[model samples]
Target: MSFHKYIFHYRFSGKSDKPLILFLHGFMGNIHEFDEAISLLTDEFYCLNIDLPGHGKTKILDDDCYKMPKIADALINLLNELQIERCFLIGYSMGGRLALYLTLKFPQRFHKIILESASPGLITDRERLERVKRDEQIARKLARSVEKDDFRKFLDNWYNQQIFGNIKNHPHFEQMIENRLQNNPKKLAKSLQLMGTGVQPSLWDKLKENKKPILLLVGENDSKFVEINRKMFAVNQLCKLKIIKKAAHNIHLENTFIFIENIRNFF
Candidate 1:
């Protein structure tokens, strides 16, 4: 509960004898998101699902805690205090980006990695700057435009995105994201602008240089991320890609059985 003044909310299963599995949720998402999937896998491994800063029960940092590097460092600190020597790190989307960043930053602390629907940060410095500017604007807008239905509007825009654009009417998938989105819009927007992978340093080179085993899973309907995964897998020899059939960006929720089976097999 009190891992350094940072207050990280987490859930774990299994005894100390088994391997540890860390679950990192996506942007604007918290530990609750992985409950269903973690429930399916913890019988074999110790699961640690964390509530990242600015989301769920975790308290926001005093300064801007939106940067990926800062958040990753905080998590690393938590692991150190937990006395966890090594563990398998798994992340989805934003969580995936952080997991890879964490593994690359401290490779020895993690054994294997699972990244679902994640990508390396913005490719060029120009792209990074552009995203940063865009995020800043969103942050400003959130401060000035906070409204009761702002969260709903954010989801509307989120669902309109190309990756998730193809998914609709799928109650489970919709519910999963809705639960994540059912929070203060101001915080969500601020977190996205500040801690977003779009604003973080690009890690494609680090991914290629790292020798750890990595699994990249995404849905077949998510064309944008699928293309990125293909490129990442082709370039990174240690990377293995898995495409879930009939699923969208939120594969774990869209096809829970397949998501659980695939990740369980990987672990």
Candidate 2:
């Protein structure tokens, strides 16, 4: 279905009467990213997996819709269209940031939220401005790569980041690359330009205002996000930080068993 100029593709699985669990994938990811985990989760909760703007089967109708708050509103409209009154939210990385935004915007709409390797954005104006410049440069590079049709090179460069070092040799690494390649490069570039963390409003101050239960998951090896989530937990007593021992940024893929177990226990 289309909402706010974006075509959203979602999959609903399991019984309708069960508590709903909405799954949002990370950047360069699609609904399929949650397949393995959802296969195990459907037994307990009905799952709603969606392809966010510019990813998978979803289409970006307007560039303005790529903003984080707009994307969150689009998802809320989607849930309303599906008649889902409330659901548990599980978001990974970029998706986690969006989930956090949505939960803050509409606190009553979510029962619980689980964020994996996500942040609340830059705390200071100086930090935000610096990040904006950095993200813009990266986004422009990605746009040029897309224009050159060098998607493989772009994917290679993206996954080569030190944060993903742990998952580089996983058996599913090739498959992961293949899935990312299916994304529309133009849309991806626009998404980054509009929705990058640099442009997102800092929600650090809103952390204490959240009353719903929050489970913040971070890979032990991803020091940056580990510290970020730690600060998040410190401010919100309802928030819990769980560090996956042997994983990095993409814990769901690198430590699938532990990731699934954490989700099961959290919700």
Candidate 3:
């Protein structure tokens, strides 16, 4: 029953009576992405930071679909291996989108959900196709000049976007992004093209319909996801939206204090 087959690595060695918290990383990221926060959270809860398929040490799934639901299936299998019935789930970016999907699809399995800059999927099919092509092109570039997967180049290209560009100026931002992007370029590229954000299902319609406690956090100026977050809060009964000042897509890294505080307040 060793989930080492599906999970790259897991972090948790403390008591079991506490609430279980599972941390999922985004595309091109792994378990180590949560090292700083996980240590702080471990005493309050048993924290499990896992590397999902196609990231970190986990082997890529054989299926070509690699969609959110399929990835969630792998996660459910991992939980089964550990005999875990339920846990609080948190996913950032790509991981966040997957978290929302899992919660909506299996509400009984999650005590609560914390989503950071994650969307269920694009609002329309056209947007999804455009995004997939754009992301796929970037992934191709990553595969070409990854430099032992140092990915400094890929990250610079990634962060150059209006929202994430200044992350380099934030004190801990560079290190956090560096650590998260240190995985193999081929894997990162494959994950992005095969199971990237565009490949996810739009959870907008489903979020309003679900009663589970869902917290959506975004940076105030992120503009892109901020609109989505606001819309959900405006119409949804069970969802809460919190925006971190002076932060963008990577609020957890840009303003860790506020990000953690909001999550603490919401949960």
TM-score per candidate: 0.90, 0.95, 0.91
Please give the distance, in angstroms, between residue 246's alpha carbon in candidate 3 and its true position after superposition.
2.8
Q: Estimate, for each residue in 17-117, the C-alpha lDDT of model 1 and write its tens digit.
A: 77898899887688777877877776777888888877787776564666677788778888887889889988999888888899889999888898899
Candidate 2, number of clashes: 0
Off by over 4 Å in 2: 147-149
lDDT of 3: 0.76
- Winning candidate number (TM-score): 2
lDDT of 3 at 49: 80
lDDT of model 1 at position 149: 69
Q: Quick one: ranking by TM-score, best first?
A: 2, 3, 1
Tens-digit lDDT track for model 2 on 102-210? 8888989999999999998889989888888887887777777763348888887888787775687888888988888888776787787788888899999998898
Error of 1 at 9 (Å): 1.8
In model 3, the Cα lDDT at residue 116 comes to 91
- Candidate 1 has a TM-score of 0.90
Query: Where is model 1 poorest over a 10-residue stretch in terms of lDDT?
Result: 142-151
Runs of candidate 1 with Cα error greater than 4 angstroms are: 1-5, 14-16, 140-145
RMSD (Cα, Å) for all candidates, in order, is 2.2, 1.5, 2.2
